[model samples]
Target: MNTLRSLTLAVSATLLGACTTLAPDYLRPDAPVASAWPGQTEAVAAPVAVADISWRDYFADARLRELIGIALENNRDLRVAALNIEKAQAQYRIQRADQFPSVALSGGQSAQRLPGDLTSSGESTISRQYSTTVGISAWELDFFGRVRSLRDQALETYLATEEARRSAQISLVAEVANAWLTLAADRELRDLARETWQTQQKSVDLTRRSFEAGAVSALDVRQAQSAMERARADAAQYASQVAKDENALAVLTGGQVPARLLPEKLIDAVTALAELPSGIPSEVLVRRPDVLQAERTLRAANANIGAARAAFFPSISLTATAGTASATLDGLFQAGSGTWTFVPQLTLPIFNAGALSASLDVAKVQREIQVAEYEKAIQSAFREVADALAERANLGEQLDARRNLVEASAESYRLSDARYRNGIDSYLVLLDAQRSRYAAEQELIAARLSEAGNRVALYKVMGGGWQ
Candidate 1:
């Protein structure tokens, strides 16, 4: 009993001493990106970081907020991401369990018949035996921290999966917002086309009347009819685009969108997406879910190297049982029937055809790959933000210029129409002015849509919508 007690204490001490991991200390790789965004003149202080802001607060429209909420609940990709996290968690748990011994209780009975020549007493005999044991079978002791390192790797993998889910959520929210805005923009364009068609039809009717009365040439009536037909074609095209946009939004949201929640025009949607703050590149990129996921994956690879290193050392395992045995079932638990076993195994790598060394090399190479991938993720994130910022810097001025063009073209059309009515200008001048005004109106709608879409892009790249 004293020998058994000392042996148990010694094993416990050895296990406690093996707490440290063989993996190298983790150090985060430097971010491979520029310090500042291109064309950034100065640092801008923002009241709130993009990551700190919730999607609900970022979008001002109540209807848009509701739609995002519904999409969050129904998006299939998000559900898959969530399931992946669960699977990773289970895998981590399984790995962690390897660090502990698995104890089991077993009971059995056996009987054997012997012939007279084979029996010790030289007589035919029947033998019966009964036994019960509680034991841990072939449990690795983790003397070299191999099991610990594997558990750490699994933990990092689970964390990476969680970040992946966060990334999917961010993408889903941004996609829904962009799709909603696109539908609104298409609807606005469709309405503009319809309005232009109606106005052009009125012009065609007036020109035909003048031609019949000998006040205008037949060419003028044909020109007006041609303009009206162009508007009719645009109207049909825009109507089709609007329907396609609706279908896209329905697929993104995972179901048909409520009519009341749908956007009516770009003018309304322009106010739906709020402005995002330009945070420092390093701080913002680190907060991004995709970037964080990459870093976690790198950490997991680092842990794998430790496990590989541990594999080059000796491993120890133990298979132990404590039980009672007797010739009869009733005597199985008698004092004299008590029996015990303790088998310890030690394995040192003597020769393996270099497989162990090759495995360690592979782990090191994989860690290098993860480091590169981590840096790449940061670079990609930086580029996305920079692109969005560059667009945002120009979008305001572009929108203003488009509005001015629309105003100027509308005035030009009004003046030319008055001149043609008073016989001061020809119908050709009036026709050109009408065409310019219609084009300017359409361009203005496009500008508004561009500005709104740019804001959505900024929100997504800045990692604002996931919250």
Candidate 2:
């Protein structure tokens, strides 16, 4: 009874000391970065957060939402991230177990035979015995919070993995949207190319007629023919690009390309939540996943420092066993046949070639490194948001100018064609106008597409879709 009470007292004392953690309390590192982005803060009007809406609600295209769903369910990267969480969880279990005693069932059997040469004792004198005991074996008691610190580290790592999975989801959604946008744009350009080809074909036929009647030279006829063929080549290339981009999107979605994607229009892929979302710089630290992941990692690192520091102190462990052992099976359940033992151990490090000290040093350095990385992540996230917003505003202005150019080109081409037919303008004049009109039309398409893409990018930067 005294021994049991003494063991209990020791355990309580050890725990009292073990509960204190040596790691410094974690604080968010202050980053002295610029608050306002160049030419963006005051100049750009504050827009409502269009990115804050749920991805499904924002991306109203039923087909796009479906594709994103499939990718989230089947993406190999997400599965890997989940597996990593499982691994970290297992490690946490192992470390937690280290804080308590481990019990094992042990048995022993022996038979001794003596040589006949030693006759007095050897008269085939053999001894046989069997014993079995269930007892706690060697275990480390957490007397300095080492095991607890390790558990904290493991938990943080597990959460970090979860964040990584979310990050993958965010990136996967963005990629599918961008690729879908590209596919749609390519389709639109292909249609434009076909239109140009048809127009050029008409001009080519007219030139051929004029050439046969000696109204125009063979060189003129050849130039018109060349223009028509170029347009056909452009159309073919656009068709090929569109097909390839669709296949790429299909692969990401883990299926073959559908006959047609939903929304039927690229602009419908993403609905802007805000015409201009407010960019409050302070919230950026929490909004970005990579930044969150970095901070968690840093926290884990800080816990490791505590774990390493604890290694310099002694480890206290308590083990007790109460079981029955007897030579004969008949005596196994006897009332007074039980045996018991209690052991308390304390081990202090003596010498280890400075290995423990080196580990502590490494952990401290790693903590510093994570601090820097965390700061860098925050700065990088802020810059991406700034750049996206700048593009969104500037692209809007450029798009307006481009709209005017498209109209002017269309008018010039029409007039040039009439003048050429009336012999008031040369075929060269018509050719120049056709080239300018075609280029202008293509640019207009690109500008519109750019505006849509910019919105998606801004959404991503402003912490929009990961939720």
Candidate 3:
């Protein structure tokens, strides 16, 4: 018992001494972009961190929030991402188990018959044995930290998978919101087109009456008819577009879009998507899911390098069994039949045709690749946020200009219509004014849609709504 105790103490000491890891310590890579976001000025007020904002608070529309909830619950891609996390967790658990011994209960009985020539007796002999044991199989002792390094790698990989699930969730929310906005925009366009068609129809009727009274040429009547037909075609086209938009929204939501949730018009829809604060600190990019995932992958690759380095050192393994054995089943558990066995092994790679060296080289290169990928993710995120900021800054001015243009065009059409009624201008002048007014109306709607969509883009690129 004294010898066994001394041996166990020595083993424990060796294990503690050998727990050193060869993996390089992890340090977060520097941001690959500017310290402050582009266009960020000293006058700009510091804003709340996007990561701290919940999706519910970011999206003010209750209906949109409900739709997003359904998408989160039922989106197939998000489901797959979640399942991947579970699988990664299981994989990590399996790898971690290697760092410790696994004991199993085993039992066996054997009987054999020997020929007369092969046996001590000149007749056939029978041999029988019975044994029961609870012991560990060949378990690597982790004397070089190989098993521990592998377990660390598995842990990092699991963390990376969890970040990937978060990325999927962020993307799903953005998609659902965009899809909802698209339906609203298309519905607005359809309404605008139908209204234009009605106004043009009245113009055509007046032109036909003038022609019948011999007050205008048939050409005037044909011009009005042409404008009316174009409006009718547009109305039909927008009707189709609206239906397609609804179908797209339904597909995004993974079910029917609730009728009550549908925005009645573009103006109403735009009001629902409130502007997000844009003066966020650049450090928030570090918390972006994709960036975090990339960093975790880099850490995992770094851990793998440690495993590869540990491969150069000798490996130690142990196998042991303690049980009772007897020639007959009746005596298997007898005190006199007690038995024990232990085997320890050491493996040194004296020659491997450069396999170990090659493995280490591969691991180092993989870590470098992951480092580059992590930087690239940060750069891409920076660009996304920058683009959104730039758009957000200018979209309001553009919308204002478009609204002014629409008003001016409306006044021009009204004056042209009055002139034509008094025979002070030709039908051609009235037709041109009508075309201008129709175009300005369409542009105004487009401008409004763009302004609204920019808000969603800002929320998405800033990594908002995934708290």
Candidate 4:
């Protein structure tokens, strides 16, 4: 009883000393980018903060929202990310278990026969023994905080993994939105090409009739036919592009894209997607998933320093058991059969060829590396947000200018066609006007697509949605 009481007191004293950790105090690294966003004055303002907005609310199109939902469910990358979190959680639990002792119950019976010459007795003898024990194995006492430090490191790693999953989700949402927008844009381009082809075909027929009547030369008819064929070729190219865009979107969704969810026209699709607010404060970048993940990685590195430092100190461990022993199975729990064992060990490192110092230095260097990575993550996020905001500042103006140019080109073509019909314009002049109008129309559609895609980019960079 006296020995057991002394053992308990010793363990209590060791645990009290476990509170000290060798790791240096953690400090968050400073942001390495500009504090304020550039070109903020030109950006549009909004009442709500972007991070508070849900993806469904930000993407107003019902089809887009449905597609995002399906992607969230079926996307293999996202599923793997979620599974990684589970795996990390289990790993953390395993590491945490080391902080405490594990008790196990064991029982066994043995029988042996001894030869007459080896036995103390003159005759051969049979012996039987039985025993049972319940005890902790070689559990560390953690007097130097080694186990605690390792547990903390594991916790930080698990947190970093969770942040990585969030980052994956953010990337997936952005990719799906971009793919859907691209499909809409290509579909619009195809329609525009078809319309241009039809109009040029009519012009070709009219020019051929005029040539047959000797009102226009063969060169005039050939120019008109050439324009018609170019438009037809453009139509075919855009048709192939639209199909390819659908395939890309389907891959993103991880399944076939439903026909009902496909955009009918680019303009309608652009109108359906709501514009994102710009000029968000640069400090919001700290909340980005990649940045947070880097910070967690830094924390894990810091915790490793504690483990390395603890290696220079003495390690204490304890193993104990209490049970019963007897010659017969019926006598196992008898009053006089009680047995017990207690072992306490301490190991002090003297010299190991500077191995401990090398380990500590390695840990410190790794922590420094993590610090740089965390700062870089913040800087990268800042640049992405800044670039998106800069684009948002001018995309509206560019789209408006392109629309006006398209309108002017169409008017010029209309006037030139009237002149050609009345024999007041050359075939070259009319052909130039028609080609200019078609090109301008295509540019306008491209500009609209850019404007819409810019909004999506801004939302993603600002850490909008995925809340």
Q: Which tens-of-lDDT digit does each residue in 173-223 have in candidate 3?
A: 888888888777778878888998898899889889989999999999999
For candidate 4, give the lDDT of residue 112.
98
lDDT of 2 by residue, 1-467 (tens): 35655776677676766477677799989764665665644533345453356678767577777777877777777778778878888887887777666768877666777777766754667666666667666656676788888888887887788777767777788888788778877888888999999989998998999989988888888888888998999999998998798778877777775665633335633553545454566565465677788888999999999999999999877777666667676766676667778887888999999999999999999999999998998888778877886777688689889989999999999999899889898888888899999999889888878887787776677666776
Best by lDDT: 1
RMSD of every candidate to native, in Å, equals 1.8, 3.0, 2.2, 2.4
lDDT for each candidate structure: 0.88, 0.77, 0.84, 0.84
Q: Which of the two, 1 or 2, has more TM-score?
A: 1
Model 2 lDDT at residue 315: 81
In model 4, which range of ten residues has the least summed lDDT? Answer: 267-276
- Model 1: weakest 10-residue lDDT segment is 266-275
Task: Please give, for residues 402-457, the per-residue lDDT of candidate 4 as tens digits.
Answer: 98999999899999989988989999999999889988988888888888888777
Q: Which lDDT tens digits does candidate 1 get at residues 260-376?
A: 999898753444435677867888889999999999999999999989999888888898888889999999977899878899999999999999899999999999999999999
Q: Give model 3's TM-score versus the native structure.
A: 0.94
Indicate whether candidate 1 or candidate 4 has the larger TM-score.
1
Which lDDT value does model 4 have at 110? 93
Give TM-scores for every candidate, taking all chains together and pairing residue i with residue i: 0.96, 0.91, 0.94, 0.94
